[model samples]
Target: MSGHSKWHNIQAKKGKVDAKRGKIFTKIGKEIVVAVKNGGPSEDTNAKLRDVVAKAKAANMPNDNIQRAIKKAAGELNSVNYETIVYEGYGPEGTAVIVECLTDNKNRTAGNVRYAFSKQGGNMGSTGCVGFMFQSKGEIVIEKTDSTDEDELMMLALDTGAEDFAAEEEVFVVTTAPEDFGKVREALSESGIEFLEAGVKMIPDTYTEIDEETAVKFQKMLDVLEDDEDVQEVYHNAEFPEGWEG
Candidate 1:
């Protein structure tokens, strides 16, 4: 809310994800399967599954696909197994990056992730190499419309267990403790509030500003990671220059 705008980062990621909508759907479907396997297939009984379902819907994943994913994970259809893995490293200019992956073959995922990092002038490190620089939090973004009232929305979010609320240039961001995310999300949804994006994310404690050269390399690394079938999400602390489109 202070240093770099999270909204801008979200928009940039959305742009990248939009270009490969099918890949995004596949990534989300993997998440759904993992969630169902961890908990049950029932959203009502599985909070993790419910959260992943909401994320899938936000990404415009078809309901049919969502149901199929659940059924498959629950063994009604063909069964599959995946392991969640998190890799942390330093991107160009020592910018911290965290990549969340889901893979049945850890060896292949690790090799691919390491290759992406090295190819783009980054170095993959051990699990906690850059993990300490981030905190897991729930972030919900709502696009500001003509009827949006900053004051009312702030109050509502706060009352619904949000830890912080910030109004950006074109959207309102609601932050909450990780454990309170579902409660706040459900409360706002029940009030007819729509979200542009909602999920638990690894938010950097501070952002690292990068020069144009470094930004280019950093983005290339991100692109490589995001394109990997095993990679689900990539989080970073790099702040690109003004009007940078990478």
Candidate 2:
């Protein structure tokens, strides 16, 4: 499968999210509580919980926050009932888009998400509308240098479990099944591989390349959704132009 960075549009917003420690903690904290409540806090037995724990650590959420979320989920402390919602739509130039959210109030969250889309010249679609256009996978990003050879990575790591591996502008994007992500990550860590970021994300099966004007609109649509309190992830079938790769 081919890959597109679209990094020029996404990097600034990622940096903004990184700066909001409180927002990051709140989102991951909710995930931890839900994961524990659903499958218990034992990562050894709970794969979903394990993923959330890893996400919490990556977000720099405090130890106490993680523990408290677990305790709350286990009934040792009070916990709120939060629901997971997936909103799908079409963005600028009719790009397929999907947004994942966790919220206690579905009505408010739904309204906000719909409004965000409409505000950016997009429209929300029914559930499962655009979901079929994407595939779910676990992805890891590692910087590329002469020291890390592509053939070596494919043979040592990708061959073992990774579904695909690609050399981006200056980084290697490693892809794996969701179930194998933890094992692959552990192996990479033991092998002394340095990584930038890793997570489970949905990759578009087909891409819609919008003109520059429509690309700006699409970026705005993504940003609005990302800024929402309930939105966890916003994905689209929009690919970056060749000129934007570097």
Candidate 3:
């Protein structure tokens, strides 16, 4: 943990993983199903479902697939029920990791996740072991080109009781109190600023740093977590050096 890069350049060059579309679709569908089952099918009434729909649209999921997911989630069609779970662990160089997932097979996911950590030079820790190292908050990313100025956004978000705000390289990161997330998101929308992404995420209290070699290994661990259809997000308390910008 000599240095840290909280923001990794995730835009590295690579061929399209379009072949993973089916895997992505299956993961997204499970998410929609769980969201609908927990909160109901109507997007207007179910905030969770609304967010899931937004995510599906962002990912370019087919309308038919979306409709079918909602149907299955509402039990209008036969499908296995899923539950939301979070896994906390330590990665290479003691980087804290939090993984969010939706799965019907808890045991299977736990085994898979643990195996990935072990093979990747990390170890899975007890639940809440690393959770305390992060805070759960709603995050929305808006483009820098938007006419919305930081001062204007700060005032508006503060008026709505937002927790924190930061203007990053290409986007603004707006953090909101968990309960006021939807309100903040809507207010931003009404202001005509387009958001790139919105969701609840775990932001680390502090970031640990590893050498370039270890950082690449940690990145591989992240790949393993994200590849799981059951896994939704993998939050780490590791940061890369700005110089290590990929």
Candidate 4:
């Protein structure tokens, strides 16, 4: 599917293993709190909170940690106000990139993001600079199984309002319009389908291929931003060379 480009970030992070597990939990926790504050605490009644829970589960976050975060978010004394910010920029070789953050301090987040881009030989741009190069959509990834039928899965996904489906070697990826994401995901869940990852993401229309040297630089930029505590997600249009193992 067109949105598969975002998977590059996930694949790259796998190389780092558990080193960032705590930071990952922190980011997801902030998202859960924001979701709770925006809607309510009940996942059954709050669609966004439900998706955040699914995301937390996908990350292998501990049940106790998840329950703690939910309780804190729903408590009356929870006063932290997080703001969602999207930063657009261009990486090495003109590759488009977008960084999404949730932070209580906008100035701190902006400075951190700007430093990452500049330090990596890239430049931060205006709000819509690189945003127009990608489409916002919902992406759901399911690990492939022995009984997975491509045709059957495609039919089921489309019937449930999915926009597109692709069966990769290890996973089946489904794309849906932002508005239909929740409904489609619910339908799939009811059918006993398990998702490896699911979220609304920015998908590039086309990928920019860079040489080996530029790929290294591009990845460093991603790593710097991803390591930031306020940064939640990073999307880029860069495509690493085939067989060039991360």
Query: Model 1's lDDT to the true fold?
Result: 0.85
User: Candidate 3, which segments miss by more than 4 Å at Cα?
Assistant: 1-25, 58-65, 75-78, 146-148, 243-246
The predictions' CA RMSDs to the true structure, in order, are 1.9, 3.1, 3.8, 1.9
**Best-fitting candidate, scored by TM-score:** 1
User: Could you tell which candidate, 1 or 4, scores higher by TM-score?
Assistant: 1
User: How much is the lDDT of residue 12 in candidate 4?
Assistant: 54
Clashing pairs in 1: none
Q: What is the C-alpha lDDT profile of model 4 across 134-182, one tens digit per residue?
A: 9999988888888878788888999999999977657788999998998
Give candidate 1 regions above 4 Å deviation: 1-5, 10-15, 76-78
Q: Rank the candidates by lDDT, best first.
A: 1, 4, 2, 3
Candidate 4 — worst ten consecutive residues by lDDT sum?
1-10
lDDT of 1 by residue, 33-124 (tens): 78877788899999999888878877778899999888877883245678889999988889999999999899999999999999988899
117 Cα displacement, candidate 3 (Å): 0.4
lDDT of 4 at 176: 95
**Which residues of candidate 2, in runs, are more than 4 Å off?**
1-14, 60-78, 145-149, 241-246
